[model samples]
Target: MEGSKKGYQFTAGQERFRNLIPRYYANSHVAIGVFDISNKASFTSLEFWIQELKRYAPSDCKIILIGNKADLKEKRQVLPKDKLPWTSESKHPKIIEISAKTLKKPNSILDSIASEGLAVKKARTLKQEEEERENERIQMYGEHSETPPMRRRKFLMCGSDRGQRK
Candidate 1:
C-alpha cells in the first residue's frame, strides 16, 4: 500500500480483511478518514468510509476528514470548491487538507483530534461528577425527598411550609 500512486486499491483479498477494521472502531474516541486529493476514486470512497465509521464506532466518536497529497496540486482531483456530501450532517466533522510527504499543516489534523478528544473527556468527567453528586444527595436524603437536605432542615426550623400546609 505504501508509495502506491493509485492510493488505496482494495483487492478481493483485502475485502475480507476489512471486517477486522470495525473492531478497532468500537473503542475509538476519534476516527480520521484520509483520502488522496489527487485521486478522484479515493475522494469518492470517503463517503463509504464515513458510513462505516458511523456504523461501527461509538455514537459519540468524533470524525476528522483529511485530504492528503496537497503538494500534488497539479494532479488534484478533489478541489477545495467541491462540497462534501457529509457536510450537511448534524455532526459536521472537521475537514482538513494536508501533504504527508511535505508535512504540510499535518499538525492541524492532530490538533483537531486532540481538541475533540479532550472535549469528550471533559464532558464524560462532568457527567460522572453530576451522577456522583446525585447519588450522594440520594443517600443523605431519601430519593423521594421533595426538598434538598439543607432546605428541608431550614423549613423545619421555621415551622412553616411557606403556608402550604393548612
Candidate 2:
C-alpha cells in the first residue's frame, strides 16, 4: 500500500503463513487485524490474533482493527454496537469497516494505516538516535559526573600530587 509518498507491504497472518509471522513481526511497525463483519466466528477470532501479535510483535507496535464485508449489511453477524464492548476492553482503539468485494474506499484505509505505520517508524528511529547520542555522552563523561572521565582522572591525580607536596 502507498501512503502519500511512502509504500508499505502487507502480509497475511493466516494459519498457512504462521511460520513467517514471527519474522514479519520482528520488523513490523504496525499490525492490522482484519475480520469479516458478516461472520461472528471471524470477529471472535480477533482475540486470538491480537494475543499472537502481542506475543511476537514489538511492544511499541501499533495495532489497527478492520471489519470487512460492510457492504453485506443484511448478512452482517457482527454489528457496530456489538464490537464496542470488546474494542473498549481491548488494546484496539477503533475499528474500520470496509467492503473488499465492493472496493469501497479501500485506498483510504490503506493510506491511513501506511501513514500511521510510517509515523511510528519515524518516532522509533528518532528515539533510537537519541539513545545513541545519550550513550555516547555517558561514555565520554562519567554516568553521574558533569566532568569528562579524563578530566576527573586528572583531577584525582593532581589532588594526590598536591597532598604529597603539602
- Tens digits of lDDT, candidate 2, 8-60: 44656557777777887886777788889989988887777677777898877
- Report the alpha-carbon TM-score of model 2 versus the true structure: 0.76
Q: Best by TM-score, which number?
A: 2
Error of 2 at 78 (Å): 1.1
For all candidates, the clash counts are 0, 0
Task: State the C-alpha lDDT per candidate.
Answer: 0.74, 0.77
Worst 10 residues of 2 by lDDT: 1-10
- 62-137 per-residue lDDT for model 1 (tens digits): 8877888999999999987676676575667776899889997866666677777666656777988999988887
Best by lDDT: 2
